[model samples]
Target: MTRVIDSAGSAYFGEAEGLLRAMRLEEALESYALAERSGHDPDACAGGRWMCHMLLGRYERAWEESDAIAARCKPDRHRFWDGKPFEGRRVIVRCLHGLGDTIQFIRYAPLVRERAKTLIVEAQPALKRLIEESRVADAVITWGEREPEWDQQIEIVELPRIFRTTLETIPAKIPYLDLPAAAPIAAYDGATDLKVGIVWASSSYNPARSIPLKQMARIFEAPGTAFFSLQAGAERSELALWRDRIVDAHTDERCVVPAAATLKKLDLIVTADTMMAHLAGAMGRPVWTLLPFHCDWRWMKRGEDSPWYPTMRLFRQPRAGDWESVVDRLQAAIEETIKGRRLVPPGDPGAQAT
Candidate 1:
């Protein structure tokens, strides 16, 4: 995506977005403040600064920014859920962010249910079916779908803030999301090889999150590995040349239940910072998430493993746009996995334990 945005505070805020992408958190913070002073959306700019603070591992500062933004924005502004407790209140948790966001943060549902008398989830239509299978909510509804009733509401992304989550306090439980009952994925051609699913692209809104499919040629060279295309959308067209090498596992784009079923059959999932990574991690499956240098704050400041998902491994670029080294590491890891295949068989419950 281009850095040229045409809207209030676009100049400074847009520059801040670019800065964040470049891993310049401190300068991004200054630009966010400048954007707010220049009449850009204060809440939006604060959200940027909140992410920057989180990337810097300054969780307390991030929480402080969240508090300030919560105070300035009203309930109608669609960013509620302050630090107040809601032990016995009827609550509605609305999914207002991307699918990966909902998939990642939905781990907090059981905690919410423990406190709230009842909890309703207003989720995106694409995720409603999968979310329902989780059995974490009293009820699940889609965007335009009607609901019985809700006494109070909170944006799903705000759950971490309301809970005052720090690196250590993060709910790192796995398999929080469940797969709906569906037919298993069609059989793969290389049954004897390690079955692995791969996704190389994210939404066009953030092209930086995507890796060129051509750059991933190394992983295909891993011996005893069967590659599957879990990738969706126009990006699937990129797989045309590699169709003979990688099995195309895509069915309907709108329905994700089938994909979840497919994931259950795979030994491992390798994807960018997209919903697939979150889905695989949430399902307690072994997943390796490839990230850009200017990655999202959720990945944290630095680490190979993620605190949010113990089963997940992160492969970040050494510097901005250097996917070659990332792929080299990936190829080596896949080879290592192949060598240790006998220790942890495919579909073994112990595979996810690591």
Candidate 2:
């Protein structure tokens, strides 16, 4: 009898996993709920539900689900901070995700600091300089280094849940991340032409978010616009194919600070959903983000503007794997902006209608 019940529960969990992979989030959420009701790994079910709620922009519910999920998965070696008043207690916040996630969530560090006596932020080595200068925490340490001593530890992404964040209540503070003053990349030669920065690809993990270099060529069709390549990594090699059409501004020493400083110099930035989008938005720069049909939850379901970044505009694919239409809309918008019409600011009813 016990074996039969266990097998049935496993089957429900398997169905849920299949639905999630197919991007049928609503169906997947139901299947996961069914699995939980059947007593098949409550933690896994809670985690799956958390993602669904997050994607749907039901952040308050997602926060609750994530807390339950984390409680079940937390390792016994580390003490988890329960978002209590930690007066006089030391805390360590670990950046356990991508660079973009760290940049987005690090805003919460200052909130955590209000309660803790000492706060240490562990981040990727590439972001050490930027995080240190932000002063969100008392100390900064790179990942994989010796673990610093603290009374309790929390993951950076988990901070949102700890603070019980909702879409309406997201701390939409701009310019939270600061960059050191530096000369703009030489590519920005003093010109009155509309200077546009572009990032055509993202990390290889989710290729769906990326637009093929050849498909994006139409964006260069707009005359009198100087395009600068903000793309880094091996993807930068693709510039050779453009025949000097887009100037590459990325370099070995161009860390977050320099890259951000360069982004601020541009009149506009058109990028796929990547770290560049977050960096540009955080700096309060005018950034138009190109997103896949099923984009990350932060962008929400449908809209031209983002609540998190007031200066950022969103251009989403009409259908999955349809970058052509998105590019068409982007091109039209670019042409309009070059003609002296600014993008409608966030909170304007007209912008929401767009």
lDDT of each: 0.85, 0.81
TM-score of candidate 1 versus the correct structure, residues matched by position = 0.85
Per-residue C-alpha lDDT of model 2 across residues 1-354, encoded as one tens digit per residue: 777766777788899888765568889899998887777888788877877787778888887886686667656333356657667889899887888999888888888899889999998887888888877789999867786688988878777777888888788888888765657556575755688899989899998988988888987878668888988878888889775678887754435777877887888999999998998888888999999987887887678998888889999888788899998898889877765543566456674211
Off by over 4 Å in 1: 1-19, 26-48, 73-76, 82-84, 180-182, 186-190, 342-354
> Which candidate has the highest TM-score of all?
2
How far residue 27's Cα lies from its native spot in candidate 2, in Å, is 3.3
Q: Give the CA lDDT, 0 to 100, for residue 260 in model 1.
A: 88
Please give the distance, in angstroms, between residue 247's alpha carbon in candidate 2 and its true position after superposition. 0.2
The alpha-carbon lDDT assigned to residue 57 of candidate 1 equals 76
Q: What are the TM-scores, per candidate, against the unseen true structure?
A: 0.85, 0.87
- Write model 1 residue lDDT over 104-177, tens digit each, in one string: 99999989999999999988888898889889999999998887676778999889878889888889877899
- What value of lDDT does candidate 2 attain over all alpha carbons? 0.81
List where candidate 2 sits over 4 angstroms from the true fold.
Answer: 1-11, 14-24, 71-83, 144-149, 341-354
